[model samples]
Target: MKRTNCKIAFNDKLLMLFAIPLLSFIIPIVFFGCRLNRQPYFNVARFFSTFIIIVLLWMVNRYILIWCRKRYPRFSDVRKRLLIQISTMLLVTLLGNNLLHYILTETIFTENPVSVFDTDHLITSNAAAMFCLIMIIGIYESIYFMHELRSSVQETENLKRENLAAQLNALRTQVNPHFLFNNLNTLISLIPENPDHAVDFVQQLSKVYRHILEVKDEKSIPLKDELDVLHAYTFLMKTRFDKNLEVNVDVPAEKLQKRIVPLSLQILMENAIKHNIVSSDKPLQINVFTDNGSLVVSNNLQMKKQVNESTGIGLNNIRNRYKMLSDAPVKVTESETNFTVSIPLIEQ
Candidate 1:
């Protein structure tokens, strides 16, 4: 609803300097046949009149173009902007031509006046007006289309950079000393209690880091691949929380090939554990599955009585990443008993 500066990326001043006079000279000959063997070799009066009309039309249409661009600056509004610009220009061209003829014939030439109603004059004049209108509009539209295309590409790149930053921040949080110490304690305890599982735990921990490094630069990954990595990350969390945190993944085999944003499930898993109560007394349950054409993550709402405030960086990161890949939204639904997040899946 706000407005941007009314500027087109094109500079038409020099263009108009050459184009207006050229159109002025050519329109008369193109629409109404010219005779070379006339008294005054060239009709300076007619040329001057046509030149004035062409200049008037050009100025009006140019202003309309700038106004429309300012009013609807977004790429999404291009259709509406073009519709308004062209319709308004066409009306102005027709009316302005008629008005200019009226001024020249009725106001200036009294005795030997031109017939403004002559069918030949009407047809030629209207045809010439349309020719100039289309030529000018075509030039403006072509430049605008290219500018918008470039702008869209730049915006997408900016989003990608921000998404990458968010991912890096999440990565830092994971490898922070606190996380390493907790996992180290778990591994130490496991070595004496169950040496085989300790070996499995170390392997899973490596898999989690390896998965993160693999997908850190990826856009979308197959659901099967994501789930494999997700299980690895969950294994590490399960080692820390034991039976207090439970994650169930239930995607059909056929749907495993469908794709999603990289590391989405793990972020949701972490989010569930962070805000909710995950203890022996009140275990947290997080479910991952496919619904319709989307991947869903839902967790029961056994919230902590006093927890650090949520910044929503995790969910927002996935959302921004998804926007670059698809128009489908990352949906979040919250109820008294549970919280749900649904991410649309992409075809392989």
Candidate 2:
């Protein structure tokens, strides 16, 4: 899952607000009541009273923090919030101490049981101090949790980006090797009858490599630049197949100025050739045009029964690359007699 900075903070704040008060109230009452031999009723009353106070404090503190966050332009600072929590805890502890001192001195059960605190008539004051201490501990835990959440989110995002880049690079590696092997075979087949065309093939192959190298690190290239490479590629295939291959291009001149994923057209062309049989008797017809906001490549399928070792990587690579750039998935359609791929055109 992709994690954003703001989302982590938001989640952490919510979890902290709910979890801390419950833990603080439950843990101390259970452990300290047993150790001090307090009656169950007394322990239960003390727990409920403390719980209510803690809940009130949590609400007030959260409201103040949220208000500060909205009012101040830079209230996102974790350090400042931590300081505020510490200061609030100290202030609450001092106020509670004074209020509890008065309550313990003037209230019932002052003389029957021993003073809860070391000093006479200061038991409530001592309880108040303990409450403040628990609050301070909760605040520290919340801060720690928030920090850890931030770090985890950042690391996850970094890993996701790196994985995406690696996959893209792997796809690129397959393309160059696949293209080279096919073009080399074409050159070999033409060597005996047309030595001149074979020489031209070698030059075209070099130009293709040069173009690939130029845009190897680029995420996308201008449509015109991609078309120039596509034309060079088709020229090589046409030289080898001659009249056996029929190609048509009908893109709007204005759209050629836009940007597209590099080698997108090349991938579609290769897929068409790999799946279909092309010869003088049955020439393969491939068409390129635009519909709506997409560049469409369609080919009449005269499929060969015995297909080559197809890894199904070309279409997958193109689809993944486009996904990174656009919201729409690259559209693919296959029928008994035709195959079409529609790729979204991106503005520069």
Candidate 3:
């Protein structure tokens, strides 16, 4: 951190190489021109002394400004940090002005031994210098703010990309070769014994895939659409397991109109099935309902002796997408008898 402070302010190298040194030379020439003399004349000694003081003063304020920026980088912290910065700059400016006055008094009076007392002229020049530097500080702050805003936006975009990738991976798992092989095996058995049921199974499987493709590009969709797709997906699942799997969706019609991340319910259902045992003796039960402004998904605890391979992104992907979309949270909890997920249903 100490080494960081020694670097050029805000990583803008031109500030040190150009702006500060150039201003140091120009400020005194423009403000204190010939005030010590009754007539206009160049005072090399006075110019050099004032330039050094201005350079030191500007550097100190610049350091303080950068330090304050680092300590309070967020936009919410802007007011508190700006107050600290401005107050510190005020103190530095006053002390610098006194040093400048003393240097000018020594160098100019020595150069011209018969000059009259011109304290008022010198004091007025110092006041103007202070105000001008404050304006310069304001300009630097604007640049810092713009840079911070850009960085924040970039971070959000990166998170969105990650969320989409996770969603794609979950979809891929649904349509992967192993899942296709098992369902096709079931279809082959059903076709000979129950042709009509086999046809319905094929249609439901197609609906599941169609819904996945349709919602791939969407950030979120109505819970109504999600449940429509969930029913299609569950049809395929129940055909595979028969009485071994039971899913109860009890959400109110009004709750279905709310929005959720695309395919969120499907992902949660997949997670529950992968981790739990589904058998004739101890059938798996999954419940979907609305509770306290959230969409609740829960399942009974019936752990499998050997769990299937998982991508581990289902819940995390929903959470990340919701963070980008709303202030609401996705909550997960596990107890002695059940595992539950409560996802906020967004209103806006």
Candidate 4:
């Protein structure tokens, strides 16, 4: 729904071609030569031959409304574009008032050619040139639809402040400082060797900071509340690589109410545990699921030999917040033994 080039501004078409033929020659010499007694020099040769037949039917109705903006574009079929722009403005207002009554009663102000079937001056000069071509195409389509509705409400408030600054930069790369100093040095050595798995790893780090403050201004969420914040972020990446991290999550309680984007599966599982090689001899894994309607994820690879260089900006901020909330496209892929991504999903 974006096509808007109805051109016009060469200094507003040289100020409407020198102010509409000087207000169409001072409105028929101030109402037919000073209030009705007519003939102020035959109303200046019939208002300059009806301002050259209303500037040749206003340049063929502004090139048929700029070719009906590329054959009726803005959201298409509006009753077949008002029945082809009111039947081509009633056939260019009946051929510009029958060629301005045969150029004022016969060729350029009379010598012989008049007989253009005058049917009462062609229905009163084609109903006053079809009411000035329907008030010039209804004031140029209401100032181009109020400047395309204020540019679609300022591009939807700049994509809602760039989707809330990419959900607060994916919750500051999931509580950054090197992922909260490796989950507080794996909760200070599991609070003295597994104090009840360090109280469920501080309740899965307060349930992944309470699901990032309950879906930070959510543009999307569900997939079972993003798989309950990816099971508290894979239980703090399985207590920082316990048995070298796994993940799985095959999705499908009827595609878990399908929706996504907000921290898109914990920023693609923290970019597969930040660039791979999770430990016990390359044990990463990952996965996540749902296929046709998208979601996917994947993983595998195993790069990490001093990995930190990736400035990917969290999968380009979840592919620009799923292109401002959906139409589908986010894919990714890779191969030589997996990397994937996919995404789509949003339906609810």
Worst 10 residues of 4 by lDDT: 2-11
Q: Write the per-residue lDDT of candidate 3 for residues 181-277, one digit (tens) a residue.
A: 9889989989999999999999988998888888888888999999999998899899999999999999988887799988899989988888999
Indicate which candidate wins on lDDT.
Answer: 1
The residue ranges of model 4 lying beyond 4 angstroms of the native Cα positions read 1-11, 15-47, 50-52, 59-83, 86-90, 93-113, 118-168, 178-225, 228-259, 262-348
* Model 2, position 340: C-alpha lDDT score: 91
Ranking by lDDT: 1, 3, 4, 2
Instruction: Report the lDDT tens digits of candidate 1 across residue range 1-348.
Output: 344333666666777899999997888777777545763233766687788889999989989989998898766787998899899999999999988877976765443356877887887888899999999998878877887788879989988887888678667767878779989999999999999999999999898888888888888899998999899989999989989888999999999989888888888888898889999999999999999999999999987878765544588788888888887899999999999999999988
lDDT of 4 by residue, 59-146 (tens): 7887787676567665436468757977887787787668666756665677324467756546656666776678777767777667
Cα RMSD (Å) between model 3 and the true structure? 6.5
Clashes of each: 0, 0, 0, 0
TM-score ranking of the models = 1, 3, 2, 4
Return the top candidate by TM-score.
1
What would the per-residue lDDT of candidate 2 be over residues 1-348, giving only the tens digit for each residue? 435234224444555566656644664455335233644333544554445555555555555555444443232465676577557756765565555434543463243343434463354345545665666457645664676677757855664564355445535644567666877788888899789988888887777768877776777899999888888889988976789998899988999988888877876787788788889888999999989999999999899999878654577667766755666679999898888999999877
Clashing pairs in 1: none
Q: Which of 1 and 4 is the better model by TM-score?
A: 1
Q: lDDT scores for all predictions? A: 0.85, 0.67, 0.79, 0.74
